[model samples]
Target: MRFFALWNPFVFVGYDIASKQQIKETVRELYSSKPHLTATIGFSFAGLSAALSGAVWTGAVATLIVLACMMFRVWMEHHFRARSSEDVGEKWVRLFVFGSLLSGFGWGLSGALLLYGTSAETQAITMGIACAILQGAAGRAYMTPGTALINISLVIGQMSIGAFAEGNYIYVPAFLLYFTFLASFIQQMVDNRLRQLNAEQTAERLFREITEKNELLRIANERLATKAYEDPLTGLANRRKFDLALAESLAASNDTGSTISLMMIDVDHFKAFNDTYGHQSGDECLQLIARAIGSSLAGRDSLVARYGGEEFVVIVRGEAPDMAIAIAERICLAVRLTSLDSLPSAPPRQTISIGLVSSRAGTPETREAMLAAADAALYKAKKGGRNRVCVHRGPCPGQQQEQDTVVPFDAAKQA
Candidate 1:
């Protein structure tokens, strides 16, 4: 029976881990419906026994006592069901009154049978059946603790009657005491099991909640990290991330004797375009240009970042000066291919100028020097004409001028 009671494998641990208020509400629901069933069962069995036995007066008295006890039990159960924990003291008092009355009636029935000179066997059988019925009814009324107590009590009463029949009156009290203690022990075991089950369920629920919270937090952290390194408008690496990547690339090149190239690209006539087409359209143009530049150099070690308004930067690792210049030409061509008609009231065409610089193999230089060299080349490209690529070949310390230049791409020739 205990195994069956504890054998629910699918018990929800989450419910046990609920707040105190929630647990109380659930207990109330479970307890509220049980007492009525117990009361009905008690009254039905009492009526049946009264009709079965030939002792009409005893049967009638027993029936009345059971009916009164059932009424009191139902009333007290209902009262407790409706009452808060704070009000349970009075409700328990009522329950104790009903229990005492029932116990006293059992004692009276035993004495009355003894006084009437009834056969001990008949008295034992009748009282045993009555006790069994009452215990079964009690099992239906209370929870595990109360049910254990009631059943053990019934077992003790049955044994005491047998002892009395054997004329071992001295042993009867001891047997009763033994069963009473046994009932308490059983009740304690049941309570312990209940507590264990509740604890396991609560732990399972907490684990699930914690797992879900961690998953949510992980996703939130990822989004935050992405936003931190990414430019919101162009969806490219921001200046901070670009600078870090540049520094790392420079360090690796310095250590491994590899070459790194940098490109500074500025949209030609961007201020004019922004003036012709409002700031919103200017933003659209920048987005279009960013996409073109990003598509042109999709190498694993290449990085594109928006340096600021109307300016972008690209870092190319392990590339020669000619290869870097070629990539810049492709970017220039890609930008020209993209239609700028979408820009509101814009000219028929738009273009960008790129300045490319490669780091020397033996000479180590700061990031600022490399950027300055590229900017000088960019100034040369703008001075000659926009929409062209210029490579920086000047000495790092002085003399800023492009050693070589590529002509601006003609839109008509782009077929």
Candidate 2:
């Protein structure tokens, strides 16, 4: 068990670093291999030109041999690509080194062999050297640093030494300047590659951070939304959320032509209970009653909410009047039987009055109307003596009032 826990396959084991290294090496080989063919073709053109420009046919045959060597290297590269990915890195490096050495030596030999202290020989050698340097720098852009540097040196070094021996003072300085230019260009490419790599790393880090922050923000927003509608004391839907839900329910019922039901429950003599037992006990009692009410009305479609003080509300759909009344009776019985033995000395036997009202939609009935109907039923239960259930149809008992108290609407039915 301990070993399995430590090496859990469902969790965070990884080879992240090795995976990135493999990716980098594969890309490096790919880039380096592609440029080799282009470089080989450029050097071959220069080789053929130098040999054909000479008076002796020996330079021509030598250039043909060099071209053949370059062609063989290109064919080898094509075959290299057919190997498996794991084998590519080593084989690619070996091929790059061989190709560089072969092409470098070929150009260098042509420069030495073709030069004869004549004006035409000087011109031919100069053209070949210039072409070699330019093509090397441009076409070998993706080669390894060591290979590029060595190849450039070999191609120009022998020719430069041979040019000065012909007694042209300017040739030595010119060769030195050309080598200096090549060195500077190589250094620039290295610097650019380094800078690009740094920039890419920084961008990757920033993107990861931004993604993490966005995910955190999404989770935080979800928490805020849940809290916004929940009552802190009972962990039930608060009055504000209840109102919104009731309105939406009413609208949906109206559209679907279904009956929308609501039950408004008030603890019997709640004010007197709170006056005798302090507000804290009253709050605890309400929480217990709310929980009982919720459990009694358990289903996916019904919603139970704390409707301020000791008043609780329930909204349900897809129920006839019989089903709705049965649920309300269950809530009343549950509240009556709820255990209060754990708390301090208080009302051991408590009861609740539930006012039930349901509206067959498409009657232009508003949420306020449904609530007024439920409140009216609740009033009848309180007036006719508490601990009972009252159901209201669509009629207002507006004129019959007890002193300053308002009469509830829809006071036609009681259970």
Candidate 3:
């Protein structure tokens, strides 16, 4: 009873590893045996059977059985290889198990046919050959322990039946003992392999988790970097980015002996506009004006930034004083024409005043001096009447007695 229980296919089904994993392992092991290798094994068994039994008929029958089994194995291997790993399941496993059974039956029948009417010495040699085949099957099929147990049982059963019918009861106990040891060895092998597979699966899962966390961290860093240098409200370069750009442009101007044009712009009566409408409308107005200014300067090599509340700044490199004035004029008209339909509670049109300063390469104008000059020009534009463009040509270090040359253009007069 214990001998039969040992060979039952369900004996190892309670292992921790999944049945699907076992199916994949079995298919992989089976396909690893190349067609030529299987052919060699089949021909060797047939050739040996004839040599030991001295019966060409038995060898011929063995050849037919081996060829039939080999062809089925080749077809099965092709079918498995063509399928995706995810698609492999119990149906395929059952098919493979059936094939293994067929193969074991064929080999066992070959052994029984070889043993029939043979001398006792020939019968002993035949049993030894059958044992060799059983050991080889166990090695090949141990990963799917159930399949291995089934094949071992079928092959050993036929071999034992042949020995008993030939009145060789003395060899029965030896076969039984050998079978016991082989079954124990197979069980140990299956346990070891399952442990290895479990370890590998755990390692793979950890690797994937680490990889996903790294990808998410990379994306968050990119967003943080962008926010560091960008204006959250307007999606424009903020003051920090503007400072860096101006410093780099100033260095480039020093090298190229070019002029650096700076424009400081302020929306006219913005405080009054905010007071008339709510803060929400003030935000909408600023967004609209920002879009107008950005559109006006499109395709120009320039950087525009919101300097502060109701104030914006622009830096244009390598342009003449007249070119700077033209750019300021464009900005004034663009802002004036800006549609306030999005802010229905606001006025029909809004206007801006721009203060321009052009610093030549050899000038000793520092960053602070240029900004002060632009601010003074903006003050001059307000004094000259709002909605005008003003340029400052004056000394860098402010002296109370030194009057700045203010060039102011009224948009209405120019029109």
lDDT scores for all predictions? Answer: 0.64, 0.66, 0.75
lDDT by residue (1-415, candidate 3, tens digit) is 2334445554443244545666555556655436324543654564465756577666677667767787887788788777865555566666777777787787777666656656555565667767777787766544566677777777777767766776777667877887788888877766666677677778878999999999999999998987998877777778998888888887787777788888999999999988898778888888888888888888888998988889999999878878888989988998888888778574668888999998855764567878888999999898888899999886644535467799888875654
Q: Could you give candidate 2's per-residue lDDT for residues 249-319 as a string of tens digits?
A: 88888888887789988888889988888788888888888888889978737988888878888998879
Candidate 3 pairs with clashing backbones: none
lDDT of 1 by residue, 104-213 (tens): 34433433332132344444544455455444433432233443344345445544664576565864677566655555445455555567657867898899999999
The TM-score values for the models, in the order shown, are 0.58, 0.76, 0.69
Task: Report the error of model 2 at residue 232, Å.
Answer: 1.2
Which window of 10 residues has the lowest lDDT sum in candidate 1?
5-14
Candidate 1 residue runs with Cα over 4 Å from true position: 1-169, 394-415
